[model samples]
Target chain A: MGIIVLKGYMIFTIVLMIVYAVRHLLFAYNRAFGKQKLYYNDIYSSRMPKISVLVPMHNEEQVLHYVLDSLLQCDYDRDRLEIIPINDNSTDRTRELLDEYHAKYEFIRPLHRDCPDRGKPAGLNDAMAVATGDIIIVFDADYRPATDMLKQLAIAFADPSVGAVMGRVIPYNANRNMLTRLINLERSGGYQVDQQARYNMGLIPQYGGTVGGFRKDLLLKMGGFNPAVLAEDTELTFRLFTNGWKVIYANSAECYEETPETWEVRGRQIRRWSRGHNNVMFRYFLRVLVTKHMNWKEKLDGILLLLVYAVPFLLAVGQLDAIALFFLHEMDILSGWWVLLFIGAYCSFGNFAPFYEIGSALTMDGIKNEVYLLPLIMYNFYFYMWTISLGFLDAIADLITGRQVVWAKTKRFTK
Target chain B: MASDHKRQIYFARTYRHLKANRAECALFLLLFILPCLVLLLLFYDELTWVMTNGAVWMIQQAGGPRAEISAGTFLPRLGPAYYAVLPTTQPDYSLILGNLAVCLGTVWVLSTGPRKGRPVAVYLSIMLLIHTMACAFFLLGKDLMPYTLEDFSDLYIKQQIGIWITFLVLIGLVMGVLGRGAILRRMLTVVSIMLYSFVLGFVRYVLFLWILYRFSVLYMPLMFFALGPFFDFLYFVAIYAISTNGVIRIYNTKKKGDWVWA
Candidate 1:
């Protein structure tokens, strides 16, 4: 009976892994080989939309100035643009710095949330309430947007179908350490290839809260942002899609942001993301399937995207099953003719997170040298299995017990 | 109006292509359907034996026919014939049900495809038939064949390593074919194909799991989720690609576009 149950779970894990792997592979393929290049054009006319840039900061005194300064240098029309900086209960000099910026720049309007329930989603919700622009753009405290980035993002709105537009995020201090380097590869694959391919395939291109813009009214209609969820970006992506709106991946609208400088910081960030994303998955998995607006392809992609955080947990379970099977002397079940199938599934399992996806992204970005570091992802996979599995447990506990989780922030480093 | 007209023309062209491929689709579907049906029949007896015996094996592993491991933890135990092709005991109706569902669900999905897609579905049935035969051959080839876990593991590892080497060689050949032609483009294509192939392989594993669960009811729930998708993947790799490329080629020809055959 225990064996039967375990076998069932193993099958469940392998199937999900296959779906996840296939989705990423399809996206990568469409981005690489699909003739119709989505977001490949830089043909934005002089007709720019009214843009409201929301910079969400929480005790971000270390890096607020850099982002604000970058925004100040943006090439968009000054009269048409408005910058709202959300100062969410910052005890440090963050509010004071925002005040300084507000005084100095005519466009910088700082919102101070002195009350409780302070996180990025909450900040975004408050900022969205008063955002006067036609298009609402978001930037994290550490992001340094290129002058033309706003224009590139705004241009996508020219097509009425585009509910949101996301730009590529390049890590500024990527060369600082090995952790940052690995993060850079991940970010590159995620944005340059994965997101791009999804866009090309007419599938879900994630609106990664930072360096992404969306229709203010659409978000407002979707009941603003869910403050309880950690990955507000992923939640918003699904919401947008299910609501008959599209999120465009503006790969050319590249912006530089700080990645975690250490493993501790990276681990915390991944955990929070996993917690938030899994929460969204529990909420949206069925909704995505039954959503009237989405086609089968979109639904498949959305569900696969929702399961992204769950893959590591599944892989970890697969590892445990392997051990259990080994001790039970049932490991031979994966031998002989089954070896090809097992190895194939195993390869697909790794591809679920790294290697070929990252390699393709790097190759597309003209940074083929980093392809050699692809093997390091084996270690990264194990790390993800550990952290993400723990996060999955926490998510499950929170979901089942109706326990509210405090939104833990990703600690920033000053470089 | 121009865009609408172009779309209409494209649809007309696509219709013609599908019309042309109907015979091929029928022929392909017919080729595999008989074998698959036979394989299904053969699977019945094997599945029954595995369920009854594998349950006993499981019971033995747990401690004995009447023994149970501590409820909280999964107590891993080795049965006497752990290396045998089929392992399990007790008749699992779920495996039989799941297989029935997969076979029917796959046929239904394939049948629902565009005119051009029906043939592709037939092609996928062929792949599934191949997978079925492989599983059947393994089970019936040598009754209750046993081996050491280490020896099996070594063989598996070596075989996988060889596959990787073969994959590298294929990529190298692709590069040679390109011969200084769009280096970045070719490299990205290779990477994408490699990743996509892994996904395809995983889908194949999913189907294998469906087949595996037939003899072992231990993981019946896994088979449930694996059902419709096994067919979906089989269809995707076998038939979907061909029909899509065919339509694209026909359209490209109509537009006098580059006849770049992939």
Candidate 2:
């Protein structure tokens, strides 16, 4: 009777798993259905939407030029666009470059900060006080979008329900070394397929901190941001979703960013992100799921994403249980070929699905770009520490202890 | 002025107290080092078994690259098998002591077992996911067995069909409950279905599967939360399922979708 119940439960679980996997596959199909890109020139009409592009910087002298050059070459509506480069407490040539660009580019406007540290959100809020545009686009110093990004983003907003749109961020110098190669693979699974999958299915996804756009009205409605947390982007996203607003994502709106050259730098950036994410989760955990007007599904998704940091530890435990069972139950588990097949089936499904989806989403022609470390991508087991531990621990501390977190900057690099 | 000098004298007393604490800082090594040594000894044979095969045995036995550590906590290579791959890298009492000291210090910082700082935790968790993914990406996505890149397009399609069903159920339930106001209720049904579909798609598809996998639905819920951080795809499905009103039919249901090439 005991064996029968166990096996019966296994059958039930397997059936449920398949049913669930099928559901997600179908959602992705609809998102991809009949969606094709419009070429830059053909889609980019001369009637440019006046965009207020904000670059809030603390000490971003390194990559300001790269961003400026990319902005100058935008595919649509550049004439009506006003570039406000907000220099937040930078005692460097960052200001000089901003001035040089302002001198050369008529659309460039520079603002300097003269206050004690308030952080990135405060910098953005200050800039928003003076911004003038129908559309607001935010970019980090390290990223440079494709020429057609503005045009593509504008077109995506044609749908009235879309409150914001997120663009794709690809590693600009992916081939830098082994570390970057692993990073490229991880990023692909993260932003490309994961974000796109959510958008296609109509779930509210956290915006990419860089490469996102907002309506001026909605921006004001959200009141800039709650500077109390490290990650303001995540906070604003949930707030916007509960208000019956939708965010759109365009995979073709390509932008490139520099991966931290080494793990040490990556570690610092992740620590700040972890702290910020923890703050966001605490502030919004139950609020987004149960109390918010959104259904159980979206809230569950939000909670799960915040809690997803805990999955690795759980899987490690599961692996132990499996190993224990091998010793305690199956002396030689190879006794059944069926077991091997079952393991193969789920393992294959778990591992491979994201790569193809992300790879295809990134390329215009749908050809996969081979980041050579593809084989060693698995070695990153040592690479993603901060995101899980710091993100999870910090989140928990903030929630339990009610300790507030402040924004920490990701030191930018230029090529 | 008298208080300032008195305060300086108080500070001088505290500096000695801190120096005394600093002398005991090296003792922190015992916490992590002791466990590592005990674990090393406990799994000695397994370590030997791995070492005999030159750690190839460890890689194979753990079932792949991601299993270097037994249950992902104690990196077993640091165990008895430490000498097999790099025999010259002898395990010294001091080195073991050092490893333990660093582990203890970090774990102390990490709190219970080095609180696994966010950097170490996220990076390690992501690495494990990538490792699992490297093992499966090709086999599932492109339909290439034993490779990277999988096509989860099916997962998305079926999610849509599930959404459609959920909305039908939700609308029927609401109509049955509030039949008096026909126009207002009808408007709500349409709006609710549209809004709820996203949440429904996410719940049914993503979170459900996550629960199934985490608890091993077959066994117990031992420490599955570790996989929680790496379960990005699972989270995506939950959001997709919950927010969707209906699920799309990726396959005709009449045929085996897995066998068909996209």
Judging by TM-score against the true structure, name the best candidate: 1
Model 2 collision count: 107
TM-score of each: 0.65, 0.55
iRMSD of all candidate structures: 16.8, 23.5
Candidate 1 to truth, TM: 0.65
Candidate number with greatest lDDT? 1
How well does model 1 score by local distance difference test?
Answer: 0.60
Tens digits of lDDT, candidate 2, B57-148: 43344443221222111223443222111111122344334433554454455434433433354334433443333223222332322110
| Tens-digit lDDT track of model 1 for A141-165 | 8999989888878888888988888
Model 1 chain A: ten consecutive residues of lowest lDDT: A334-343
Q: What are the runs in model 2 whose C-alpha is more than 4 Å off? A: A1-47, A76-79, A291-297, A313-372, A385-387, A401-404, B1-262
